[model samples]
Target: MSYSHLLLALSVVFVWGTNFVVIRWGLDGLPPFLFATLRFAFSALPWLLFIRRPAVPWQKLAAFGMLLGVGQFALLFLAMRADISPGLASLVIQVQVFFTIGLSLLTLGERVRGYQLAGLALAVAGLAVIATHLDATLTVKGLALVLAAAFFWACANMVVKTVGRVDMLGFMVWTSLFAVPPLFALSWWLEGPQAMASGVMHASVGVWACVLWQAIGNTLFGYGVWNWLLARHPAATITPMALLVPVFGMGASALSLGEPLPLWKLAAGALVLCGLVVIVVWPRLRTALLRTNA
Candidate 1:
């Protein structure tokens, strides 16, 4: 990655990692679904005027909107509201790699590499460690919801790839626009009028800031650079940057929220990082060695 692209990727990790804390703060007054609705609503506003339709078709765009913008964020927001530890939530959501891999195989007939398989194993083992600490109440439903969120995100990834060609920023803006109504409906049906009213009345500036950060910083700026990098470089070169998410997520949680770093979670994180490094970098290293010998 170029220095600028790397910076944008890091910015994404930072914003997304800290987003757990922001969501937690937002939940203080807002009901979960309502907060989500307000979040996307605010996010879609600036882009409503400026963003053009993506080159992708409406069918694919709508599906992408439902899966990614609505399903993923909605389930994730609920999981956070259910009090899943932010650090752990960050860690667990990385399971989207596993889901993405599975979807690619099923949809695109891509083969899962041996290194990816090994990385998946290490990641799963680490997730087991994290799950062992969950309270009984937090165990079944909340975790399931988060996992569902990951699946939705993975499905959205498939949609994006399937669409083949579009401006990623345009896609994001349009999908978010498609996301608003359903989310508002969900809020109304699930959270009701009174809670929404109270939340709107009491919503803090920080909450609005978080919404903006997620919309502009994370979605537009972050994915803009990422899509550009993917366009310019091979997946082999760029995909490894994702391994940084867990690291930044855990670090940000610790630094911002004073969340304790457990030894097991730390160990699992290290393993995941190591596994991803081996998967992403080892092939390049082997090629370099072969060239040197030749």
Candidate 2:
């Protein structure tokens, strides 16, 4: 990657990393389901007017949207609203990596490598560490919800893999169309109509700004630039930068929200990141070694 492209990747990850903080701000007024409804609504509309839908089955699109918007984000927002801090939410959601691997093994009959198994074990250990340290800030319900969200995120990834390559930006927008109505219905049912009305009426400018940031900055700009980079470079070259997300998430939470980072948290992060390093980097190293030997 060129210096400029490197900066672009960094910017995308930064936006994504800080997005947890943005979600926390937005939840100050709106209920989780309502907040999620508005997020996908704004993400789809206006741009959806201009962007052509990708050439994929409506069922596939709808499935991906539901998995991503409702399964992943709704649960995530709810967890963050009451149970978990943004920093830990960011970290916990990364378990989707392991979930995706497990799903592929079961659903697609893909063989797991030694490194992947090692990575999974390490990540599970990290989760076990987190499970032992629950408190007012990090409740069991919150951890469970986030894990569910991560599972859904992994399911969404499977949908993408099945769909093959298409215009992902367009896919995101159109599928977002499928996500909105269900989310609105869910908000009405669970959060209550009165709460939704009150939230809309009393929403401050800052909260609205956070919502827009989630839609425009995090979704549009972040995914847009990320896909652009992937188009230009190898997946291996660009994807590893995602490891910075939790790092930035934890740092931003500490700086902005004053969320403390105890030794346990640091240890958990190290174990999980080292696992990810083995999964992502070890393959590249092995391939290079094989080429040199050959």
Candidate 3:
């Protein structure tokens, strides 16, 4: 990638990474489901007015929207609200890569490579380490919720793969539209109308900014630039930049939220990040080794 493009990729990941912190900020004023509802609502409206919907079936759009907006983000917001710190949330959610692999194996009959298995094992170990160390910042409920969110994210990935290539931005916008009603219903049912009303009424300007950031900065701009880069470059070239997300997530959490980076947390991060590295890098390495042997 050229220097400018690399910087662009970095900016996207930075937005994505810091998004956990933004979610934390938003949750301070709004209930989780309500926060999610507003985020998707803004993400879809006005833009969806002008942008044409992708050619995919409405069913597909609805499914992806629920999985992403409700299953993934709603749960994620809930977890962040009470259970997990933003830093760890950012790190732990990445287990979705492994979940995606596992789902593909079962659903699509895709073969798993040794490196993928190795990566899974390493990531599992890291998660186990986290499980053993739950405290004020990291709770059992938080970890479980985030893991569930990761599974939902993997499911969303399957939806995308099934849909094949379409206008990703349009797909996201339309799917986001489908996500809003259900999320509002969920907020009403679970968080209670009183809570939602109170949150909205009492929300600060900063909280609203966080909500807008989630819609425009994190969802639209982040994915917009990312897809643009993928269109211009190979997936292998573009995708690996995602590894920086957790690094930035943890760093931002520490810097912004004063989240502590204890030694154990560092070790766990190393293990998980190393596993991700192996998963992303091993295929390229294997191909290069085969050519060398030839």
Candidate 4:
């Protein structure tokens, strides 16, 4: 990637990394489901009117919304609500890589390469280390739900792979469109109508800022830059920078939320990042170096 594109990619990751902290703040004023409802609701409007809808099947788009939006965010929001710190949530969600690889193997009959298996082992060890401390800070239920969210995210990626080419921005808009009603219904069902209503009515300006930032900053601009970079560069080149997301998340949470960074947690995060590098960056580097030698 060129310097400019690299910078753009890093900027997108930073926005996404900080997003967990924003979600925690938003949940203070909005129920987890309600916050998700607002996130998709705001993301779909005005801009959705301008973005042309992609030609992918409506069913595929709907599934994408269910998996990535409702499924992922609901679980993630609840995970944070259970006292999982933002930085830790960010790191744990990287398990999506293992889930994606596993799903691809099962659904597509893809072979599990040695490198991927090694990465998976390291990733699992990293998660186990985090798991050792979960009872003290975050609940087991919360950790399990976050893992489920990561699984759904992986499933959503598979849906994207099946859909082939699309207008990423429009797909995102329409996915949010698909997510709104169900999320609101879930807000009422799970969070209770009265509680959700009270949360909505009593929400502070800071809450609104968090919601809008999530809609515009994290979802819109984040995906916009990501899709742009993907269009210009190979996915291999563009994606590895996202490994920095947890690094940013850890630092930002420490600075802003006063989240304590224990050495064990940091070590786990480093292991996770290293595993990601092994899976995502190593193959490309090997190929390049081999070409150079030849």
Candidate 5:
């Protein structure tokens, strides 16, 4: 990745990492599925009027949107509602990194070489530290749902990769159109009318602001650039950056949510950083080493 696109990828993950806290706050005043519905509504509408549809096929775009929006956020939000810690949720979702690599290899015949695989192993070990040190907030039900969300996220990565390059902003906005109906449909079935209505009526200003940020900052900018990067680089290279999410999520949680920054989490963050360094630098290092020997 170029320096500029690397910066863009970092920005995307930062917004996404902080978004866990935002989702927690939003869910406090809104039901999971309904909040998810409103999130897409705010993300997609109005802009839909301004931006032209992307050149991708209708079915492909719709499938990508549903997976990206519903398969990811709806299940994720519901898991959080089931009492998964925001920090843990962020960490566990990095399972999508492995899922992406595996699916990319199977579907696209992409190869994961020495440094990438090694870095991935280190990152998974970092996650294992956090997982083994789980607190009361970690539940089997929530973990299962989040892993499911991660799988859909990995599949959605392939969708964007398969579509290749196009208008990323327009594509995000358009895919969101397909996502909204299903979210509302599912919300109605899952979150009862009375429960959903009551939650909306009692929503606080903090919740409203969080929802707006989640929509504009997280959805528009984060997902837009993420898709752009996946289109620009190989999936294996682009996906490793997600390991940074739990690091950022843990820090954000400590600051905003009063979650303790345990030593193990800090150590895990360091391991993740080392893993990212290997992913970023190993290619150039190997090339230079070969050149010197020659």
Candidate 6:
């Protein structure tokens, strides 16, 4: 990878890592759906003003938004609100990686490599440990919701790979546009107009700050740079950089929220990180150092 690409990847990891803390902080004052709604609303402002609508068909755009924006965040926020540890939540959502790969095979005809299969096996085992170790009397419903969010994320990934021929930033912008109304509608319907009204009126400035960071810092800058890098580099170079996000998420959550690092969670993190190193970094390093340098 070029130095510039490496730097961009690092920026994404940093922003994404810090986002977990922002979510936790934002949740303190804002209801989950309300927070998600306002987040996209804030994120959409710049896109509406500057970026043109994406060239993709309307159905594709709407589907992408439904999966990535409404489906993913709705469940994620609820899971967080249900007291799934932020760090653990970061770790768990990674199940999407495997799901994405699996779905890509079925839908996009992308082949899943042997090593990827191994990584999936390890991830599943790790999830078992995490789920088994959850606090007694904790229902799997919240965990199931988060996993469902991951499935939506996987579907969105496939959408981007298949349908996102337009500029990456533009795709995000339009999808967010398509997504915002449905999200707000869902919030209004389920959480009630009065609760949302009360939430807006009573939300703290700190909560707003959290929303801003999530929208601008994480969503815009983070995804913007990420899409840029994806356009510039090979998937081999770009995709693995995302693995670092969960590390940052877990660590930041633990530190910011005073969440514990159970022995199993730490072990699972090590396994996942090690697998990422093997899948992403090791191959690029070998190719660059041996083939190119030689």
Clashing pairs in 5: none
Give residue 81's lDDT in candidate 5 (0 to 100): 89
C-alpha-based local distance difference test score of model 4? 0.77
Candidate 6, TM-score vs. the true structure? 0.86
Clash pairs detected, candidate 6: none
lDDT of 5 at 74: 94
Clashes of each: 0, 0, 0, 0, 0, 0
Candidate 2's TM-score reads: 0.85
CA displacement after TM-score superposition, residue 155 of candidate 5 (Å): 0.9
The Cα local distance difference test for each model comes to 0.71, 0.80, 0.81, 0.77, 0.91, 0.73
Clashes by residue pair, model 4? none
Whose lDDT is higher: candidate 2's or candidate 5's?
A: 5
Off by over 4 Å in 1: 1-11, 135-137, 223-243
Error of 3 at 69 (Å): 1.4
| lDDT value, residue 17 of candidate 5 | 92
lDDT (Cα, tens digit) per residue for candidate 6, span 221-252: 77667756655543434555565666778678
User: Number of the top candidate by lDDT?
Assistant: 5
- For 197-248, candidate 2 gives per-residue lDDT tens digits of 9999999999999988888898767765765565565433454456556767
**RMSD to true structure for each model, in Å:** 2.7, 3.5, 3.7, 3.2, 1.2, 3.0
* Candidate 4's TM-score: 0.84
